[model samples]
Target chain A: MNVFVVGVGLIGGSFAIDIKAAFNEAKIYGVDRSEDNLEEALSLGLIDYISNLDELDKADVVIIAIPVDATVEILPTILDKIDDNCLVFDAGSTKKKLCSTVEHHDKRRNYLAVHPIAGTEFSGPQAAIANLYRGKTNIICEVEKTAFKLQEKGMEIFSRLGMRIRYMDPSSHDKHIAYVSHLSHISSFMLGKTVIEKEKNERDIFDMAGSGFASTVRLAKSSPAMWAPIFKHNKENIIETLEEYIANLAQFKELIENDDFLAVYREMEDTNHIKTILKGIA
Target chain B: MNVFVVGVGLIGGSFAIDIKAAFNEAKIYGVDRSEDNLEEALSLGLIDYISNLDELDKADVVIIAIPVDATVEILPTILDKIDDNCLVFDAGSTKKKLCSTVEHHDKRRNYLAVHPIAGTEFSGPQAAIANLYRGKTNIICEVEKTAFKLQEKGMEIFSRLGMRIRYMDPSSHDKHIAYVSHLSHISSFMLGKTVIEKEKNERDIFDMAGSGFASTVRLAKSSPAMWAPIFKHNKENIIETLEEYIANLAQFKELIENDDFLAVYREMEDTNHIKTILKGIA
Candidate 1:
């Protein structure tokens, strides 16, 4: 089997490593606009060789794992080039734009929109690791739009990578991810900015930060190049979620300012249900 | 040496376990208003036995690990009951109030104000673990106010627990901690609250949440009983930091709303410095 993975960064690079392990006989090809990433992925043994878009007809499977904006621009073109028997899928954070771009394409049945719910704060090919998809959730949007044979092949691949699959419409996937994923990155980035702006002494941050602070601020270290497009593609949903988050912060501040310790305590107690919710993810 | 640890929750219970390992010959006594916690601590072998306030005089070392409000109410009394040779210290998140409360006490020389910067989202005696303090920071405020002999002994204990000691004035400690620690907790709790309020489907949250959301919201699960007092005691600094955080978030929202993706990208790029800052913490 020939598998071509485009945009060899964290998501694509990790997929290449894990998929190769799952199917040792599969030949994995790497494609990236960045020469440095292609070099890193190749040196890391994440791909057998560097390939190009011209080779699309030779691939049995094509995985698009780039920024959402880039994925939107290139996904239809990739579909235009792939052979009829090839299965194509994208692993972008926001799915509505890409799914809609290919909604009426001649090869629409060959393409699937997927968001594998996994990642670390780090990025680049160097950040890829084996088993990243193990026990993680993979959301497939508009799966019914894909050909049945390609869907079966996609399910087999996800099962081999140890990922559990869930299906949703593209619009619902965008809304929910705006709350659970995109908003978190923005909150953490803003938190890091606030702390850096207020705290003059970096040494104090280093010495005083406990595990809680570290965990909360960890996402602030994510790649801006990768995330800006996601926030752009899902602007409306992200904006709505951001407004709600700011209002929540404002309400919490008012409670604290009013010396309403009971209200503050109750607010946190109510949010503690996230613990039970997170256990499901774990 | 005989040691007495009051309020055997996460911090106190972990301290009991480590202190016992460090000084095997020391008789560790547990004291708490909560009988269930006391029983749990004893069963976990976190303490040699359960003791009472009347037994304070029998202790050569007294460690008060409780809520900041309770620490303010009880620290002076613990100092008053301890013998002149006994070393008394309190591990509370907020230090300014506690330090000022005992600033002029006659036995102030025998007490040390310490905040060991280590913890998990969970609490109680069952949450205690060995080496919780290993390689973590221990902030000792007003170290000069402690007796010379007791200071040496305190250093010995911190060293044995594998903690690096950083000394600062109580006011400075409270301010820095508000920015780095307390503010992170509030942001996380509020983020969790915002998401919970908006995302009604718990299953969607479970399936959609990536590791970034989990880490960013992890502290929402922390004990409300423990954090409310910390926020109450550090209200001024916390309010100041919280306001700055809200302003930063508002600014980011404005950038996103105006479609200035470059500014959003640059903001996150700047905060990427947190990666270097966190490496110092590790």
Candidate 2:
């Protein structure tokens, strides 16, 4: 099998590496706007060939693993260029907008709108890995629009990559993902920004941060190029979630100010159930 | 040596278990408000005897591992009851009030204020483990107040437990910890509350939570009884920190509302340096 991956950053680049590891006979091709990322992917042997849309003719499968904004922008052109048999898929964090954007395309049946629910706070071709997607959930939306053969081909590769496939409507995926994944990025970036502003000294932050602080602030390091568009696409839901997040923070702030020990404790105690919820999902 | 560990919940209980496990000859005694916690402690062999203030004469060392409020309220009583040669340490998060409470006590020489930077969000005796403190840093405030002999003893025990002991003033410890640990709990708890409010259904949360959300919100599951008082004691610093946090959220929220993709991306891009900082500390 041959795979042509666009963007060649963390998600695409990592997928390329992992796919080749899973299927030794597979040949991977890398495509990206950045020469450095493409070079790194090739040097790392994440790809056997590097080319642009001109080579889409011979590609067996095409993966759009770029940031959400780029994925939405370039998807239509790629769809127009792909052959009828190409198994097209995307690893975007959001789905509704991308699926809707390409819903009317001639090659729409060739695409599988997918979101593999796994990634670290890191990004770029250098951050790619062989096992980045193993044992994680891969969300597939609007599958019926995809031809049976194409969907099956994508699923077989995803299964080989060790992902658990889940099905959902694009709208539902967007709403739920806003709460679970998108809002977390916003909260983390804000938390990091807040402390950096308050401390006014990076040195102080470096000296004092413990493991808990590091884990909580981890996502603050994610690529702006990738996340900015996610927040933009999921804006309404992100804003609604943000308002709720700020309200919760304000309520806790008031409880702390009043020295309302019981209220503060009970509020935190109430949210402690997140442990069970998180553990169950993992 | 005989060690009396009061309030043997997660922190104290784990400490007791590790201490006993590492040193077979040390006699460990347990005291707690919960009969079940004490029974669990006994059944786990974390301690060798059930003792109290009435039996204070038996312990050559006393470890107060209770809520911050309780530690401030009980330290003087426990200090006055202990033998002159005995070393007493409190494994509480905040140290300002606890240290101040024992400032002029004659036996202040016997009391050491220590905060071990190790724990999970889980609580109680069942959360006790043999090696929670290994390779972690434990902060000891006002070590000069503790007599050289007892300080040496405490260091030996912590060292044998595979912990690194760093010393600082109580006032500084309280302020720095607000940024490093307590503030993290507030941010995470509020994040959990925000997601809960938005989702309005636990099932949605269960199905959608990915590893990113899990690690980011891990601190939200921490025991409120343990955290509220820590915030109460460190209120001023926490308020300043919380205000900065709110302001950061507002700034990010406005950027999202305005579609300032560059600002959104750059903010996260800048904060990503936390990866370098975390790499150094961890």
Candidate 3:
């Protein structure tokens, strides 16, 4: 089995690692614009050979795991090069744009839109680790558009990788992800910016930050190259969520200023329902 | 040694556990307005006996670990009842108000203003766990104001718990804590509120929410009875932090709306400096 992994970085490299481990016959091929990443992935044993789009016809499976913007730009070329029997899937954050980009392609039935909801704050081939998708949800947008045989092939791999599947339309996937995933990165980045700007003494922030602050601001360290594009491709949905978030923060600030602490307490008590929601997450 | 733990919840109950383990001769007495909490503490073995302020004369040390508003109300009364040699400290989030409330008390020298920068999202006696303070920062405000003998006694216990001490003025502690701790809680709570209000389908939030959302929103699960008082006591500092955070969010949204993703990328890249600062935190 020939598996070609484009954009040999965290998500792609992690998938390469798990696929190789699960299937003894799998020969993982790396396709990345960065020579450094390809070399690093090779040395890290995340991939067996350096390959490119021209050789994709021989590929039995291809995983496109790049920035969402790049996925929108290059997904059609990938579909053009793959054989009719080949199963091609993308692990992009925003699915609506990518699905729309390749909607009219002749090989649309060979393509599956996948988003395995897993990542760390770190990125790049060096950040890749085994079993990243274990116990993690894999959101498949427009799964019904893909050929049944390819869907079965993808499901077998997802099952072996220890991931659960959730199906939704491309539009719903983009809208919901803006709230759960994209909005979180924006919130974390802004929290980090606010603290960095206000707390002049770097030493004090370091000395005083508790686990709560650390966990809340953890996503501020995510790769800007990856997230900036996600924010762009899902701009409308993201802007809507940000407006709601800003309004919430403004209202909370007013309650504090007015000494209306009873309202403040009630607000927090209502939001504590997140505890039960979070329990169902992983 | 008789140790009195007021408001036997996460912070106070945790201290009770550590104090009992560290001091072989120590007898921990629970003091709370809630009879149910006292009963739970007794069953959990977090306290040796249910005691009250009237019995303060027997206390070798008193840890007031209730809400900050309540701490301000009762700290002076606690100081008045303790013996001259009894070391009294309060583990509240804000320090300036508590220090000022008992600033000129006759037994002021017996009181030590402490903000041990440690806790979990859970509260109450059932949430108590041993070694909660290990390797965490303990911010001691106005340490010189406490009697030298009592200071030594408090320092001895802090050392036994493996806590590192950082001396900060009460005003400075509250100001910096607003950025690091208090601001994070507000941000998390508001984030949770925004998601819950916008995502009408709770099932989508549950199935699609990733680990990033869970981590960023974890503080939303915090005890409102505890945090509402902290927000009230540290109003000025918290409001300032909230304003700055909201402004940053608005600016980022405008940049996204205008398609200035370069600026968005730069903002996140700059905030990535938090990675280095967080390395210093335990």
Ranking by TM-score: 3, 1, 2
In candidate 1 the C-alpha lDDT for residue B275 amounts to 91
lDDT of 2 at A115: 90
Chain A TM-scores of all predicted models: 0.98, 0.97, 0.98
Each model's Cα RMSD: 1.1, 1.9, 1.0
Clashing pairs in 1: none
Candidate 1 C-alpha lDDT tens digits along A113-218 = 9999998888889988999999999999998899999999999999999998999999988998988888889889988888888775556656889888889999
TM-score of each: 0.98, 0.95, 0.99
TM-score of candidate 2's A chain against the true A chain: 0.97
Q: Give the Å error, residue B219, model 2.
A: 0.9
Question: Top model by lDDT, which number?
Answer: 3
Highest DockQ, which number? 3
Output the worst ten-in-a-row residue range by lDDT, candidate 2 chain A.
A200-209
Candidate 1 chain B lDDT trough over 10 residues, lowest sum: B198-207
lDDT (C-alpha) at residue B124 in model 3: 92
lDDT of 2 at B141: 92
Tell the DockQ for candidate 1: 0.82
Worst 10 residues of 1 chain A by lDDT: A198-207
Q: Tens-digit lDDT track for model 3 on B181-260?
A: 99999999999999998875656556888899999999999999999999999999999999999999999999999999
Structure candidate 3, residue pairs in collision = none
